[model samples]
Target: MNKTAVITGATSGFGLAAARRFAAAGWNLVLTGRREERLAQIKDELAQTSVLTLVLDVCDTEAVQAAFSGLAAPFNQVDVLINNAGLALGTEPAQACDLAQWHTMIDTNIKGLTTVTHALLPKLIETGRGASIINIGSIAANWPYPGGNVYCGTKAFVEQFSLSLRCDLAGTGVRVSCLAPGLSESEFTLVRTGGDQEAYDNLYKGAHAIQPDDIADTLLWLARLPAHLNINTLEIMPVSQSWSPFAVKRDQ
Candidate 1:
């Protein structure tokens, strides 16, 4: 029997790429994005596969609950849930940052993810063995840097929550995994930088940053793994990316 995968933030980046990857593999896709036009375009481009597009902002709790609860037919029998609808706002340090931006990150990255996961648990449990919840986290959750304040915190929650959730689903056949990627080149940087083209360009100029397709491929691998196997957490970073020495400061 063919499987179904639900991908959020499917308008662009990793979510869109994963939708295409799974579609190419003959999986039914339920794609949710805040942008109606982009969702329409994706629905058209991936016409070869079964596609259901929902204009959804995961931050809206009622909308998320309603959308998932309302899935029909094969789409309702979801095998994989890709929680990719997340973003980082300003790069300003905590004290200088807008409190609103902090809340927005918390809303989308943390609250939004959990709401959808909660809404879909019943469906995933119904699907039983081989069911998977692949949460898109960030290396920021593990490694802290300047200006990463709230974004880091939210992703840390994603990582920890994925672990805790795995414990809760122990008896069930549902698998929970968190993917933490580092230095990816996508609209994510543009969104985080407030559409600053220069900043986006400079950040990835020669970094050989990880691509959305890479993450999508990884998701496919995880999804296609044997039913008896479960990968709890996977961290991916491009060869060009690595750790930096601890910052040191001395009084002048």
Candidate 2:
């Protein structure tokens, strides 16, 4: 039987790329996103694969539960879940950042991810042995930087949550992995910059950052790995990206 993979935030970026990648691999797809039109387009594009599009906002807890509960037949038998619905809003210092943006990040990245995982755990356990949960974490989770604030905190929570989940689901044969990526070229930067095309262009001008397709390829590999092998955490960064020198403030 062809395996089924459910990817959240399937409208764009990593989620969208992963949807295409999995579809090409002949996996049945349950792709969820806030954009109904885009989801429909994706479904149509991957017509050869069994596709079910759920117009959903992962931040909506009630909707998350409803979406999973309402799944029928093959789509309901989830072999892999790609928790890719997340974002980083505004690049401002902690005190300068808007409280609402902070809350939104926490809601989507932490609450939303956990909500989806909780709803899908039973099906994953039932599928057993080869089941997988790939949480799209970030380098921000491990290395703090200015203007990261709550977005960083939320990702850190994802890493820890993934680890704890593995411990809790130990005997269930459900594998949890956190995939943290650094410096990628996607609409993610556009969202963070609030659609400043110049800023987006400048940031990635010469940086051969990790692409969505690259991440998608990684996800495919993870899903195809042997049932007994589990990768707890995998961090990938482009050669063009690396650690910066620690900043020190001089006394004036």
Candidate 3:
């Protein structure tokens, strides 16, 4: 039987790339995204594979449960879940950042991720088969940068949460892994900068950042690994990206 993988944020970026990779590998996919048109497009694109498209906002707690409860037959039993629906809003310092943006990040990245995981974990355990939950995180979680604020904190929660989950699900054979990528160019920057094209280009112009496909390929490898093998956490960065010197305030 072909395995099934459910990916959130399937409209674009890592999520979409992972969905395509999964389909190509002959896995059935349940794709969730906020954009109906994009969801439809992806569904059509993955027509060769079993694709169940759902227009969803992960932040909507009620909708998350509704979507899962409504899953029919074979799709209901998910073998792998890719929690790729997350974002970073605004590139301003914590003191200068908008509270609303902070709230949005928390809602989607932290609350939303946990919401889906909480809802489906029981089912994953019930399957009594090897299962995995891959949470999408970022370098911001470990190394702080200017204007990171709540977005960094949210990702930190993801990495930490993944570790804790592995402990809880240790004996159950439910695998947990967190994929953290650094300096990747995608809709992420556009969303963070609120669609400033110039800003987006400037940040990635010379940086050969890790592509969405790179991350997707990594995800596939993780999921395909033997059930006895579990990767607790894996972090990747573009060759052009690295740690920066600590910022220090000096007397003017």
Candidate 4:
């Protein structure tokens, strides 16, 4: 029987790329995203593959519950759970950041991912054969920057939560991994800068940031690994990206 993988935030970025990759590999895919039209477009693109689309906002607990409660066949017993529904709101310092943006980050990045994982973990455990959970975290979890305050915190939670899931799923034949990417050229900067095309272009200019497909490839590798091995955390960055010197204030 072909395995089943449920990927959240499947409308774009790594989620969409991963969905395409997995479907091509013969796995039945259950794709979820907030945008219904985009989800329909993806479903059509993967017509040859068994695809089930759920239009949902993971942050909405009621909607999430309702969507999962009546999952159709082929999506009922999920084997791979990809908790990828997350985003960063604003690139502002803590003090200068908008509270609404902060809350949006917390709601989608932290709360939404957790809620999805919590709801789907049981299905993975129930599989009892071979299962895996991949959480898309970020390098911001470990490295701090001026404008990465709360976004960093939320990813930190994701990294730690992924570790905890490994401990909880030990000996259950269920693997949990966190894939943290340093810099990526995608809608990330666009969304972060609130659709500022110039900001998006400037951020990726000569940066050669990792592409969404790069992450999708990593997801494919982790998901295809032997049931005996588990990668607790994997961090990747584009060759052009590296750590920066610590910031220090000096007397003017």
lDDT ranking of the models: 1, 2, 3, 4
Better model by lDDT: candidate 2 vs candidate 3: 2
* Per-model TM against the reference: 0.99, 0.99, 0.98, 0.98
What is the C-alpha local distance difference test score of each model?
0.95, 0.95, 0.91, 0.91
Error of 3 at 9 (Å): 0.6
Candidate 3 lDDT score at position 143: 93
Worst 10 residues of 2 by lDDT: 67-76
RMSD (CA, Å), each prediction:
0.6, 0.6, 0.9, 0.9
Indicate the TM-score of model 4: 0.98
Query: What residue runs in model 2 are displaced by over 4 Å at the alpha carbon?
Result: none
With candidate 1 superimposed using the best TM-score fit, by how many Å does residue 106's alpha carbon deviate from the native?
0.1
Per-residue accuracy of model 3 over 161-218 as CA lDDT, tens digit each: 9999999997888899999999998998999999999999999998998999999999
Encode model 1's per-residue lDDT on 132-247: one tens digit a residue: 99999999999999999999999999999999999999989999999999999999999998999999999999899999999999999999999889999999999998999999
Question: lDDT by residue for model 2 over 176-203, one digit each (tens)?
Answer: 9999999999999999889999999999
Cα misplacement distance, residue 72 of candidate 1 (Å): 0.9
